[model samples]
Target: MKKRGGIRTAALALALSLSLSGCFFRGADELYAVPQPPKDYEALKVRLSEVIAAGGEYAAPLSGELIQTVQLQDLDGDGQKEAIAFFRFSSDEKPLKIYIFRQVGEEYEVLTVIEGAGTAINCVDYVQMDDEPYKEIVVSWQMSEQVHSLAAYSIGPGEVEELLRTDYNSYKLYDLDQDNQQELVVFRTPTDGPPQAELYDFHGVLGKTDTAPLSGGITAVADGGVQAGYLMDWVPALFAVSTYGGNGTITDIFTCRDGKLENITLDPDMGESRETVQFYTQVTGTDINNDGIMELPQPTPLVDYKITTATPNFWLIHWRQFDAQGEAHPVFTTYHNDRDGWYFILPETLGNNLTLARSDLPGGGERAVTFSYWEGDEAVEPKPFLTIYKLTGTNRVSRASLPGRFVLFPAEGLAGANDANTIYAAEFRDGWDCGLTEDEVRERFAIIKTDWLGNS
Candidate 1:
């Protein structure tokens, strides 16, 4: 459990980014570990300036954290597509180290970076382990504001297992029984109300108090719940697409029998709540031209910053469409997106429910990217951007433009690099390798390459 097997956890994101700003004196005997962006931030800032000249000190290399969940598959069959990072290596106070790998061809090694919850600070995020199939990574940290801390790792090959360490928080991993595996849900705060989802099987010895149900708090992400959506095998019977907050929030899915957490299914009404979700994307429900009955489109409302307000301004974004038996509706949106409003309901047979395809980025406005995430004094960060759109016609959407200057990074303001977990421009294959379906990730992020419409 300690020495070189599974958990080591002690990452030095620029020596906790120069000791979380307070700065310090020589202490880099060796602790480079950097991973993010266009060749992992210039090869970890030139090997962290040679580990700060082998620890002599000059300073200025604290720029990490913007990975938001790793792993891309290819398994290793190798065609290309193996670059995992999962961020938050420093900027202390919480969000301790984590870092998985997959660069191969050019040296980005290091496939693990535990941190096993000592000073706590988790935030990993990932799901899809219904019983035992694949995907299963969760970090979730807080330990206060009503206690929140949980760990559950599971990436293999090079090795990475720890699985389970609850007290729960508002967690989510998805896939509540279409039978693909992937489940783990909680609402562990002070629990003044809704926020109770479960589906345990966390792996190995069973331990960690073990879990079972697949439905309990299908609601409670807070503010009266309303996340509703996501089931593409995020984890076995992993459903938690809320709508209310009364009994456990609006119900929809939730599997895992024998042990508890019921409510097997629901999703026909889908009425209220959207007064303020803000933005979110991810949809793929075939039927293509074959058109029989399938259409689930989402991901279009790029809000890097800037919002039109009549008075009522709301913000929340998240979606994972594909219903009508395809299962997956982890909805959440109240969006305004420069007055776009919102609506997401895919899986009709893809006859074109919406987002046939749309995009923007050839050159329009915002595109710096940094979704933000720190929590604990509650930062939430991430806000710079000018353009990012992808929405065909109907509900088809994708937007961007959040400029006020939208930049922050004193201690690391909008420091969250490139849409970590909240997803941004999904369904791409040539670079991330395999797994594409939201109509092949909106036709590979709606190729524009060189369009018109006020040309880019």
Candidate 2:
């Protein structure tokens, strides 16, 4: 999902030259956001300059973590790191070339050069594919606007071997069979049929071991919704989030066992329904309880909302996880407010007799969201129990010293560029016999931060 536009060769040619010139400096008026290469990287930068000077220029990766022209890693696990650079010659017909250099006595020497076909590099990673103790390189190249090609290379002393090459829509590396070794899982969406997943393992050469049908097609794989987690009995599984171009989302679970890959959500023998989860708002799968296992979000209708209606004002998210045999086990339930970047876990005592409503503050420019008894649509009296304030600017500063209101989320790490004023506070009320108390609210309420979902 970490995609960026291709950098022009002319612009990169100058940037690469100046970035390694050893004289570029940040001015006092500048933001100083760009990072300079470390002193130890000087030798590798010099070697790169020599390669580019020969009527060639390096291109930065269009997508992936390793977007730089040069990347350093210990490919052979020999205690010393090697340098890998992506470049292309103006005179060559190929779109890209890869150069690998090994360290030798305070300098680097060329180990091998590879010819690649693609507009730009997509991703670069290393994994142990065999018992040789040396890691294999996993590189994905952008073949076109919608297609990408993946290849694995085994780098050795003066030898660079290509182990496998294939095209994929989305890819993941996981130990699907709990074998203590990694397997490559590629998801593809054919134009004529539903999407499918192909699992490959290393048997002298990387080959397809099994395949499974996905819940949805290309739209389901929107922006790379695949992830890795464990099922019941500690069995490793992959989760794919799919949307069928409607007001609903689906969670597809895939696992490998006994030499077969199965989509547990669709397998008839598992006795699980393939129904898409309908929700009024957006919902993506995540570890809501921080248990390391991803829970699928199921939208349950609110207490006062009409269950048969097509739309509901609010929803209670029931997070569920699957067992080894593809049976779902409910974990916890919460009220998720994605727009406000937070969620409140409903305690067991609260049950299903509460409802939430939002209103503007008496004064302008602030909001107060209240949770109270589930009154009917026509009821005039709502026994309010908890009121959360969304404050900004002077209101936020003044509420920090208020008496009955407790600040839940401060504006420290959740502020945006234009506005440094944001706060969520809970105002206590007296004589309301709701199952939740002030202490319980503090323990159950949480701020939603997804720093864990990096480049997935």
Candidate 3:
């Protein structure tokens, strides 16, 4: 949601001022004057049909078959809401009409008429561009083919002025810099090259931002307005763009700085390739560690390249945090593989109690990996566990489990630790008092291997 610290304050002040005036109040305890009834849809539709029938150059045939979409909002902030309607005259041609209607007592009056809008209307939203109590109307519509257009209009007493217009595929309104004013973030993807993202202020001025080129065309761009942490409070907005091709899928973070969109660099120690094991479709900014700074939660597929058999695919949730200098660092990652299905937990705290352990198969054979959780005092007898091992020289992955033991619960599939060629599990207890040590639990639970092998 767009931040409205200043807009809300102004609205409250306006309500108080109306209450102090001689306006009639419905109730004694009512803080503000009662608002007039909204314009009736049937009445507005009748007025639109009459106006279209009263032929003009802009008039078009109005049939019952044509699709009509209507929305009502107080575009001018006059306490009474206005109606905006879109009429589709033909599906084969790029001809559409948009009508704005105002309510004057029991009758509906035409405020503005926009002819030949486009083939179809995309969306309409009211956004505050400045300190004015009234908001500007933003309309995004399809112009032709893959081309889209966006227009912003300032609606006032019987006057409509177009404030801005541009070509865009998608756009969002957000207070990127947390300056109590919102900026427009527009994205455009060309058929010939990588996608372009632009930031524009309320005054329709474009940002002097620099964007890094990606060889593989851009596949997705996620909006990080709501999840933006402290860093977004300082910049205009935070966004993540994903590109794919010969270089694999690469995800980069971008934010506004010095009136320019700058790319954030990941810490070198986090490895050379920023691409994950699988393609990342979504990226959200969140405070995973509660450090006030925003962290990124990227979900990807989990796979072992050496395995050739049918291995079960699970999701791996990777957490990326940024330092003071805007360098990203990998914090923690984990996954769950229960018999039902695969699951990836986020925010760190949800999967913190789980751990993954690596151990050698009995007789010093192939190495194995297992996911376990701390059972604490609520331990179940004959604990069930699943392990994965690769056959020697075949590069085929196999799954084995201790027969007769119950399967590991989804909550117990958290990753523990892998060290000294050994996988260790932890114990979790309630009330901070289940008297059980990690070593004691490991000693009580003997590592037994069964000859039950199946294709992964």
Rank list by lDDT: 2, 3, 1
Model 2, TM vs. native: 0.82
**Best-to-worst ranking by TM-score:** 2, 3, 1
lDDT of candidate 1 at residue 42, scale 0 to 100: 55
Candidate 3 lDDT by residue in tens digits, 1-456: 232222111111233244423122223343121233223334554675664454321222222211224444555555655655555555324456667777555566777666446755655667777666677766666666666678877655445567678876556676665666666766665677656666677544323234433213445442211223345334333444444543334444456655555445433455222542135433334554556666565565544323344642444567766543555568666353232122223223334333344555565434545443434223432121333332222211112122322222222322311112232223232322324443333333322212110112
Best by TM-score: 2
TM-scores for all candidates: the values are 0.23, 0.82, 0.54
User: What would the TM-score be for candidate 3 when compared with the true structure?
Assistant: 0.54
Q: Candidate 2 on 150-193: residue-level lDDT in tens? A: 88887655556777888777788888876666888888777787
lDDT, model 3: 0.46
Each candidate: what lDDT? 0.36, 0.67, 0.46
Q: RMSD per prediction, one decimal?
A: 22.4, 7.5, 14.6
Instruction: Decide which is better by TM-score, 2 or 3.
Output: 2
* CA error at residue 257 for candidate 1, angstroms: 7.9
Model 1: residues with Cα > 4 Å off, grouped in runs: 1-104, 109-119, 123-126, 129-137, 143-146, 149-178, 187-190, 198-456
Per-residue accuracy of model 1 over 122-235 as CA lDDT, tens digit each: 345445554433445666555555456677766654566676676754555544444455555564433464334545653443233224332333333432122334334332
